[model samples]
Target: MYHYDNYDQTLVDERVAQFKGQTERFLAGELTEEQFRPLRLMNGLYIQRHAPMLRVAIPYGLLSSRQLRMLAQIARRYDQGYGHFTTRQNIQYNWPKLEEVPEILEQLATVEMHAIQTSGNCIRNTTSDHLAGVAQDELEDPRPYCEIIRQWSTLHPEFAFLPRKFKIAVSGAQKDRAATQVHDIGLQLVKGDDGETGFEVLVGGGLGRTPIIGVMIRPFLEKRHLLSYLEAILRVYNRYGRRDNKYKARIKILVKELGQDQFAERVEAEWAMIRDQLLLDQAEINRVQAFFQPHPYAELPAEDAILAAHKQCDAAFAAWFRHNSVAHKVPGYRVAFVSLKPLGIAPGDMTDRQMDAVADLAERYSFGEIRVTHTQNLVLADVRQSDLYELWQALTALDLATPNIGTASDIISCPGLDFCSLANATSIPIANGIQQIFDSLDYLYDLGDLRINISGCMNGCGHHTVGHIGILGVDKKGEEWYQITLGGSSANQASLGERLGPAIAKEDVIHAMEAIFQTYREQRLDDEAFLETVRRVGIEPFQERVYGDH
Candidate 1:
């Protein structure tokens, strides 16, 4: 993790002080609601359906054990006893009082964390692969680049307020776990034909009211020009992106209105003007890269006999090992995913006690660091294979060891009508219902690699557009209805899901999903993944099963 220096600390301290004054003014009636909207938004405070929601940025999803403990303390003292981890790899406190938010910000500042750029029409959090440095097949660690972008975008005077909130994701791995294709700017680290590292830049990719996979704006962007090229893209969007309508203000919309070629041309022209001035020096690049160097790992064998024995002895342990643990770049280590989608709880909600315990676990087992994933899960990226059994037992006791990582039960969902004012229907309950339907571990394993993403509305906060099975909440004459989509993905083959059919009533959502699953089970070929089956046979078969007799 990149530690904050004097400059970083000073900037955050100043922002906290400024926001504290702004919040005090609002509470004292010196500032009206309309007047305080932008001020509060800039600080990552949102007036939700019930209370104020405070979104704290976990930059590139990295959190030290100390920072995690601070979050737990904030959850315990300020808001309710829990915080919701979001798709952006951030954390949200839903019940924080308006008057007490400044105190929360001040506390976060002490831990080198803040709520800046987590919301509003500005460059939001820059997210990356959860297993960045630890992934087995990565061209390079993307965190340094993500950190560079964060420093550049945070409160940049040129892009302080864009037409709409912008998101950026980077992936260095062969697998696109960061969902880079669906971001305003997606950077894929790749080796050029000349054997030099560069970025394959994609622009105008987003999921909201209108969902579109990004177009390749630059086939290969040299490492030196990364920031300058980004600046060029932002300049093009800021100058031409729509401001008359919020719904039409995303860079994706701009790219759609103007052809992809035209958009690329505009960015290129802008880049030609400023690329030389903004070129990155080698010293600066090395400074950022040094922070993310490989950890001091011990030389251990690839296989551990004790770990193998434990897996052979306990069925539950074996299940967890298979589902929750991923191969690490290091020989004797694994990246263990902490599943947040338990049976009854909201998908990403982690209690204060669990947070503290996880922090302790991270310190003891992995290095004293935890990672938040885009799938609303946590990652202990450097867990040794020899220590797997003890860690699994500890996580089990804390109710964090659910052996369903990519299964149907591991749902990705948003805080719908329950918390978000923009939501039309409740997403938490729908996610719960789906989890209940797929409660059987054996059934889940048999179903295989199914992603169920649920969003309350078209804002697509849940990333429903990219799920294998997407459930979208729709309002029908005050009655809650759910719409389903199939075959969407954000991986190497990124594509938006297609709508299944007419919306199903809330009561029948579970049944509708069951029908779709049954259809897959019956129609799929030998060991075919849900996504492959969907693409092979199309959604027509599943749609017919859901709406055939209706």
Candidate 2:
């Protein structure tokens, strides 16, 4: 994890003092609600349906065990006994008092964390693969660049208060776990012919009311020019991106209206003027890279007999090993994913006890490091293979070992109408409903590698547009309804899902989803994945199966 320097601490401390004053003024009736709106938003505080929701940024989803403990303490102290981990790799406290938020920010600053840029139309958190350095198939570690971007964009005066919120993702792996293709700027770190690294820059990709995959603006941007190129792109968007309507304010719309060619040309023209001024030198890059150098690892055998014996002895342990663990770059290590999607509990909700338990596990087994994933899960990125059984036992005791990381049961869902004022229906309940319907671990494992995502509204907070099965909440004639889509993905070959059919009544959503799955079971070839079957047979079969009775 990147430690905060003196300058970083000073900036966060000053911001906390500023917000404390602002909050006191608002409570004392010195600042009107309208006047306090932007200020509160800039601080990542939202007036939710029930109470003030505070979003705390977890930069690049990396957290030290100390930070995790701090979050647990915050959850127990300021708000409820739990917090919700979000798809953007951030965390939300839905019941914090508006006045106590400054204290919360102050607590976060102690651990080198903050809520800045988590909301309010500024450059949001720069996210990367949860297993960035540890993944077996990565081209290079991308977090150094992600940190650079975080430093450059944090409180950038020129880009603050843009027409709409902006998101950026960087992928170091060929598998694209970061969902780079669906961000405002998607950066793929790749090597050039000279054996030096650069980025494949894609711009204009986003999801919401209107979803579009990013277009490749430059085939390869040299490492030195990454920040300069990004500056140019933002400059062009700030100049010409939509401001008249919030719905049309995203860079995707700008790219759409101007056409990719015109957009590229304009960015190039802007780059010519300011590229030299903003270039990041090699020394700066090396400075950031040093913060993430590999930890001291011990020599161990590639395979452990005890691990193999444990897998043979316990079926539950075997299931967890198969579903939740991935290969690590090191010979004796495995990256273990902790699933938050257990049945009946809200997906991504973590109790203070659970948070503290995870922190303990990270400290004991993963070099005191933890990572948050885009799927609202956590990662023990450098766990030794020999300690798998012990860690699994600890996690299972905490109700965190669901073993459904990529299964249908591992759902990505947003806090919908229950907490969010923008939501049309309750997302957590719908997610629970689906989980209940698919309760059998055997069944979920059989239905391998399926992604199910639900969003409360069209804002696509859950990234529903890219799920293998996507559900969006809708309002119809004073009742809650749901619209389903199929074939969407956020992987290397990303694509938007097509709507399955007309929106279904909320109560019948589970049945409709079951019908679609049944159709797939009957039509798919042997060993065919859900997405493969969808692409091979198209959405027509599922659509007919879901809506034909109506």
Number of the top-ranking candidate, with lDDT as the measure: 1
Give Cα-based local distance difference scores for all models.
Answer: 0.94, 0.93
CA error at residue 459 for candidate 2, angstroms: 0.9
Over 4 Å off, model 2? none
Residue pairs of candidate 1 with colliding backbone atoms: none
Over 60-145, each residue of candidate 1 has an lDDT whose tens digit, in order, gives 99999999999999999998899999999999999999899999999999999999989889999999999999988998999999
lDDT for each residue of candidate 2 in 394-428, tens digit (9 for 90 to 100)? 99999999998998988999999999999988899
Query: What's the C-alpha lDDT at position 91 in model 2?
Result: 95
- TM-scores vs. true structure, each candidate: 0.99, 0.99
Give RMSD to native, each candidate. Answer: 0.7, 0.8
